[model samples]
Target: MTKHKCFLGLAILATLVATPAQAEEVSRKAADLMAQNSNSTDSVDQNSNNTQPPNTPLSPSLPSEPLYGGSDTASKLPASNYWYVSGSVGSASPGNDVQGSSIFNNKLNFALDSTSSWNIAGGYQRGNYRSELEISYSSFDVNNASIDTQSFPFSGNVSTTSILGNTYWDIPTGSKFRPYLGVGIGAGILSGKIKYQGQEADLGTGSSFAYQGKVGLEYELARKGNAFVEFKYLGIGKYQNDAGRDVTPPNSYGVNVGYRLGF
Candidate 1:
């Protein structure tokens, strides 16, 4: 009976010890499960943060094209308009066929000689065109004279001055040398004195309408200057002197050389 009682007491003590160990193992397993759940939740939160969208900008980016449809090369082109002035000197050949009425009511005719001519001008130029105001002067020597088909030895000098408005057009050749044509209309004054048989008569001074035509070739000397040579024809209208004598001046041909300058 004592042995049986001792065996029962040992069995009860073993049961108590086993109960505490089982409780400790259950607590440890619960802690491990909670830690695993917390790690999984943290991993999910980190992945959500990494996958979020970025912040937007305040304005859009600019385009790569140029503004206002303009190109870089077009801004570098030369100017197309400017102002200029010019002068020329030349030789003139007067026509021999000059006619007039003498005081004696006789038909008079004159033969003339060549002379020197000169001019100065100022103007504006645009593109291939030009317009100018010109003042010119020329002179002639009388070779001989005749009254009613009767010839005589005559010695005299005739001089003329003109003011003209001229326009010119330059032809494009895509070279430094350019060709041009011109026309002018204006007024002129003519004056002369003649001697025959020791008697001198004043042909007097007169004013008339005048006109001219020109053709020329220009050579570029620099950006601001050009040299030119030209041929021209000038004609003066009929003139009536103070003495009541009617006179018609002859046509004149000329060759000129000149320079033109620009600003």
Candidate 2:
């Protein structure tokens, strides 16, 4: 009985020792499994972070193209077919003569008295010179200085008609203004009797040669025409009397405002 009891005790001791060893082995295996699972989770998280792409901003679209539309017609106009008329109201005065040999200096006095005159003219422009033809009419009051038998003072009226050919050399300054110098030669008819010292002097109807020189400025009012204001010195040569006496002719000068058209 004693031996059997001893054998049972030994069996119980072996059972306790084997149970502790198996439990220890089970705990080590579970700890290794947990460490491996944690390492696998860390690898998965690192791969996910490394493989992520950077964000990109969206770009705006380009603007649309501009449309173009129109016609072309600006260089087709005629420029040189124009005509003009001119009128002026001004005075006529004589010049100074120191030597006193100027017969028409102060010997004859003419009063325009702000009278108005008209001229019809046409022009053809070529390069920088304009050629013109003019027909004009003017009137003046003439006073003769020579006394009569009683030595009384007198004055008379005269009407002069002229037809002239003129040429002007133009100096163009810019787009709007041009200053010019011009000359003209013409034939004129002088009429009406003169009163010398209150007596009628028989100055017959006669034809006289006439000339004009001018300097003026013109402003372009149209595409091919200009409005002008000018100062002119006009000369009418001497006349012949009935007894072949060389009588004094009309020597006048005045300011003229006029227009010129191009052709």
Candidate 3:
């Protein structure tokens, strides 16, 4: 036992006095000597050394990016692409020698009065041109009626409803106000009542070929609204009503004030 103790003491002193290079070499040798006593501790150390940083792996290409913004393309589109609707109210000025029916050519020499009128229309526009369909109504009360320029005839009311397809060319002044001229051709229906010699007669109803010409100007009010004034000339064909009351109203003229909405 005394001899074993002296040997162990000498080995420890040698290790402590050695240089770093020599120490590592000597430690390897000493670990071999300590293996019998330190095997259990070495097992724990191996478990700790097993933990390490993870390695990154290669991946596929990234996906494409997406586009942005609103889907309401119509709102951003040009003015030419807009569709619009309009309405108007105005006066119907009558013409002379309103004839009716194939019967007596019962020519009516009536002194007609200007009266109230209204119209509605819808259209599509592009550049400086527009195309539209319109329906208009007007009527007047007669103060006197004659047959063939003689003062012996029926007197009462005359009314007409017209539907027309129209197109216009806008004259731009580089301002908010736009002026235009247009023409239309379509059909009109006429009907009303009159009295002759204390006997009342139904003016009846008739459909005739019709045509018109118009001039107008529009003032922009809002982004989608406009106010306008228009003047128009109307020519209607002769036709008799259901009551055999032959009548053709004279060509008439009118002036109108209107509003329009667009999208």
Candidate 4:
């Protein structure tokens, strides 16, 4: 009976010791599982922050090349070619020694008086060059005449109308003023009347080749307008009068003032 009692006591002691050891092992395993779960959650949060979108830019980008061939400012410059119209009025002085033949077959010479002249023109201007079509008119009075060296006061007048094609070269002065040289070739019609020693005569209308030369100074008044003063020389070929006499028209010199407008 005593041995059985002892055995029962030993069994009770062994169960108590094994129960505490198993409880310690279970507590350690629970701590390892909690630590693993916390590490996994932290890794997921780090990945989300790295994958977020990047920041936006502050300004737009610009182009590298120019819009035109020459330079950036070339496309904004004004035009160099244009069309223009002009008009002028001036005084004309004819050459003194105008020679012709009288109906009585006598050699005659005339001295002409200063007269008024006018012109209108339309043209195209390209940079320093210009081309134009012009119409002009003038009238001269005879101051005196000589029949083979015997001089006499004369009463007569001659008028001319001309159409010309003209060209000019403008010199650049880097200012508002420009100097120009011009030449023209064309046709003229001459017509008039004469009364000498109480004998009335008609100098019949006739057409002849004509030419002119010019030198001028131009002042710019605005972007599309200018004023000018010029000196001109005009000449015409010979033609016949009503009396069937060949008449040589005199060459003329003129000083003109004018204005030009551009389109």
| TM-scores, one per candidate | 0.69, 0.56, 0.65, 0.69
In order, how many clashes per candidate? Answer: 0, 0, 4, 0
Q: Write candidate 4's Cα lDDT for 113-179 as tens digits.
A: 8999999999987877889999999888877888887988877888889899999988877666889
Candidate 1 lDDT score at position 245:
82
lDDT for each residue of candidate 1 in 95-152, tens digit (9 for 90 to 100):
6567888777898887889989999998887767889999989888888999998999
CA lDDT, candidate 1, residue 55: 80
**lDDT tens digits by residue: candidate 3, 1-263:** 45445546656766799877786676566656566546767888988997754564456568865432222133322245468999999998886645554255656566677889999999977667889999999887777776665776457888889999999987866655889999999999887777777887676789889999999998767655679999999889887677656567667899999998888
The CA lDDT at 21 in model 2 is 75
Q: What clash pairs does model 3 have?
A: 99-247, 99-248, 100-246, 100-247
TM-score for candidate 2, please give it.
0.56
Please rank every candidate by TM-score, starting with the best: 1, 4, 3, 2
Clash pairs, candidate 1, are none
* Clashing residue pairs in candidate 2 (N, C-alpha, C atoms within 3 angstroms): none
Residue 104 displacement in candidate 4 (angstroms): 2.2
- Candidate 3 positional error at 194, Å: 0.4
Which is superior by TM-score, 1 or 3? 1
Span of ten consecutive residues with least summed lDDT in model 2: 96-105
- All candidates' lDDT scores? 0.81, 0.60, 0.77, 0.81
Question: For all the candidates, what are their Cα RMSDs to the real structure?
Answer: 13.6, 18.6, 11.9, 12.7
